[model samples]
Target: MSNKIAILLATYNGEYHLREQLQSILYQTHSDWHLFIRDDGSTDGTLDIIKDYASRIANITIVDNAGEYTGSAAGNFFKLLHFSDYEGFDYISLSDQDDVWAPNKLQAALAYLSLDRAGGYSSNLISYDNAMMRTSYIDKSQAQKNFDYFFQGGSAGCTYVFTREACLLIQRKTVNITTYKGRSHDWLIYAICRANDIPWVLDRQAYIFYRQHANNVWGAKSAFSGLVSKFKILRSGWYRDNVIWVAENSGADVKGVEVFERVKRNKLVDKFYLLTIVSQLRRSKRECNLLVLILLFLF
Candidate 1:
C-alpha cells in the first residue's frame, strides 16, 4: 500500500502565480497526496482559483479562516497546522503558493526520510526571480550541523516534510498556543525538533523553485546581505527571547525546557553568565559567529 501524504498550503493574495503552483502539485509523480489549503483573507481572485481547482480536484480541501487575514505567513501556516485533520495521513508537507515544485519533490523527501528514524525532512531549494529566471540554489549541507538548527539560516518551511509521529507531537504539544508572538513557524518547528532530540534529515537535493518577489514576508538573503538583519535581532535581543518562546510553546517534553525558563526569568546580569556558558546561544553561521559572540557578551 502507498503512504498517504497531506500537503498543507496557506495562501494570501496569490492569484497571479497560484495556478502555476497548483499545476505543479497536480503533476506530481507521487500521486497519493491530498492538498489542505487555508486562505488568509485574500482580497483578489486567489479564492476563485482555489475554487476552480477544488471543483475539478477530488483531493483538494479548503479550510475557512473566518475571513480574517493572518498577519504573517508563519501565523497562517500555524493556523493550518492547528485546524487540519491529521488522521489517516502518514506524512505532512508544507507548500508555498507561488513556487513551482519538482515532480519528484515528495518522493525524494520520503526516500531520505524513510531510510532512517528521522522525525522530519527538509531540502535545499532552487530559487527563481519574479521573471522565472533561475537565481541560485539554497544550500542545506552546512546547515546539517547540530548548532546550525538554532540559527534559522538555511531552513525553509516549504521544504519541510514531517513524519506522522512528528506531526502528532507538534499537534498535541502546540494545541494550547494561543499566539506565536511573531515567531516564525519554520524556525519554531526546527527548534522543536532540536529540543526534542528528534532526528531529522536535511536533503541536498533542490526540489522546489523558491520564488522571490516584493511581497515575500522574508526574501532570500545571501550570507553577506543577512548580517545587518542578524545584528538587529541580536541587538534587540529578540533572538534570545525567541529561543525561550519556542522552548515554552514546544510543550513539556522538550529538552532544555528548564534552561529556557531560567533564561526567561533571569536578571540582566545573569543573562551574560548563562549565554556565554551555553553554546546554543552562539547559533549564527561562521560568517557572523564573531558578531554574535560579541553581542551576547555585551548585551
Candidate 2:
C-alpha cells in the first residue's frame, strides 16, 4: 500500500488565502497525502474554494463547521478529530488556513520523526521554522539555526505533525486532561509527550510560513497587551497547569491506565526519580543556598 499522510486544515473564514495554500501543497515534492479541510463556520467563500479544488483533488475531505468559535484550541482540534473518526491517516499534521508549506516540509518532518520514533511505539511531535509571510524576517541561514532554538521552547504549531500513535494516545491515554479554554495548544501537546515518557524531536524548521492577520484567534501576537497579557506571558511556570488541564478537558476516563503506566516505567536514575525527589528537595535548600545568593546578587 502507498504511504499516506493527512493534513488537518482547521479553518474559519479563511477565503482570503485558502486557494494559494492548497496550491502550495499540490506543488509538494511528495503528493501522496490527503487534505482534511474543516470549515469552522466560514462566512467567507472558503468552502467555495475547497469545493472548487475538491473536484480536481481526489484526497480532499471536508468537514463543515459553524462560526461559533469553540472557545479553545483544544476544543477546536478535538472537534476536528471527532469529525474525521481519527481514521485512514498514516501521519497526521496540523494545518492552518493562511500558511504556506514549503515543498520539503513533509519530507523533512517525517525524516526526523522516523528516526526519533524508530520503534514506532508511541506518540511524537515534529515542528518547523516559519517565516511571517507579508512581514519582514531573516535569511536562510538564520532560519535554519532558529528552527532548533525556537523548537527548544516547544512549538508554535503552524506545522506540527503527529504520528497515528500520537492520536491514539490522545484518544486512549490522555482522556481526562484538565486543560483550560484560551490556553496553549502547543504547550499542552509537548507536555503530554513529556508526561507519557513519549519521545519528540525538532525537524529543523521545514520551510513553513505563518501568515499573520488581524482576525487571527491564535498565532501572531505583537508583544503582550496590558497587565493581563503580561501576566499570561510572565507566568513562566504555568506549563504544569496546562498539562493537568488538557487531561481534565478531554472528558475521558484515563484513570489507572496511561499516566500510571508512564510513572511506573520511569528510570530510577531520572532527575525526578520518585525515590530521590524527597531527599533532593530536602537537600536543595541547603545545596542551593550559595546558588541562591549568587542569583540574588546577579539580579
Candidate 3:
C-alpha cells in the first residue's frame, strides 16, 4: 500500500498567497495526501478561499474550531496537532500558508524517511523574495550535534515530514504544554524527537520555496542580520528561558541541560562553564563560535 500523508496547515489572513500555496500542494507528485487546515480566526478572505477549495477537493478538510483565535502560528499548529485525526494517516507533514512546494517534495521526503528508517525528516529550503526577484538557499541540513536541538530547530517547519510514530510522539510530549513561552513549535518538535532518541533525517536538499515577505512571521534574513537578530534575542534572556523550558518539558537528559540551568543564574562561573562544552550545543561551527562570544561578553 502507498503511504498516506496528512498535511497540517495553520492559517490566518493568508488570502494573498493562499491560492498559490494550495495549488502547489495539489500539484504534488505524491497525490495520496489529505490536507487538514485550521484557520485561526482569519479576518481576510482566507476562509473564503479555503472553503472554495474544500468544496471541490474531496480530501481537503477544514478542521474543527475554524474561527477560533490562536494567538500565534505555533499555537494554531498545536491546536491542529491536538484536534486533527492524525493517526489515520501513515505520515504527517506541515505546511505554511505562503510557501510553494516542489512537485516531488512529499515523494522525496517519504523516500528518504523509508530508506533510512527514520522517524522524522526535514530539509533545506530556497528562500524567495518576490520584490527583490532574488532567491537564497537556506541550508539547515548541517551536521547534527549532540544537544543541538536545545539551541536550534532541525530545519524550517514547513519542510518537516514525520512518520505516524513520530507525530504521535510529538503530540504526547506537547500535550501538557500549557504555555509555549514564545518557542516555535518546530523547535519544540525537533527537541522532543531528539531528546527521546528518535532518528531524524536532515536532508541536504531543497524541496520548498520559502516565501519571504514583510508579513512573514519569521522570514529569512541576510546572514549578518540574522546573527544580529539572534544576538538581540539572546540578550533578552528569552533564548535561555526557552532552553530551560524545552529541557524540562521534553525530558532532555543531556548534561548540557544542567549546565544551562546554572547559566540561567547569570553567574560568571556558570556562564564560563557553558563555554567549555559549547561545541555540543549548536550544529554549525560559526554558530558555536558566536555562542561562545555571546556567553563570554553578552551573558
Clashes of each: 0, 16, 0
Q: For model 2, where is the 10-residue window of minimal lDDT?
A: 141-150
lDDT of model number 1: 0.76
Report the poorest 10 consecutive residues by lDDT, candidate 3: 251-260
On the 0 to 100 scale, the lDDT of residue 66 in model 3 is: 44
Model 1 per-residue lDDT at 130: 54
The model with the greatest TM-score is 3
TM-score of every model?
Answer: 0.85, 0.65, 0.94
Q: CA RMSD for every model?
A: 3.2, 8.9, 1.9
Off by over 4 Å in 1: 131-134, 143-150, 222-234, 251-254, 257-294, 297-299
For candidate 2, give the lDDT of residue 22.
88
Predicted model with the maximum lDDT: 3
Give lDDT: candidate 2, residue 289.
50
**Model 2 lDDT, residue 91, Cα:** 72
lDDT of 1 by residue, 64-122 (tens): 88876767788788888878558888899999999999999988888888797688888
lDDT of each: 0.76, 0.53, 0.86
Candidate 3's C-alpha runs over 4 A off are 223-228, 253-257
Residue 243 error for model 3, in Å?
1.1
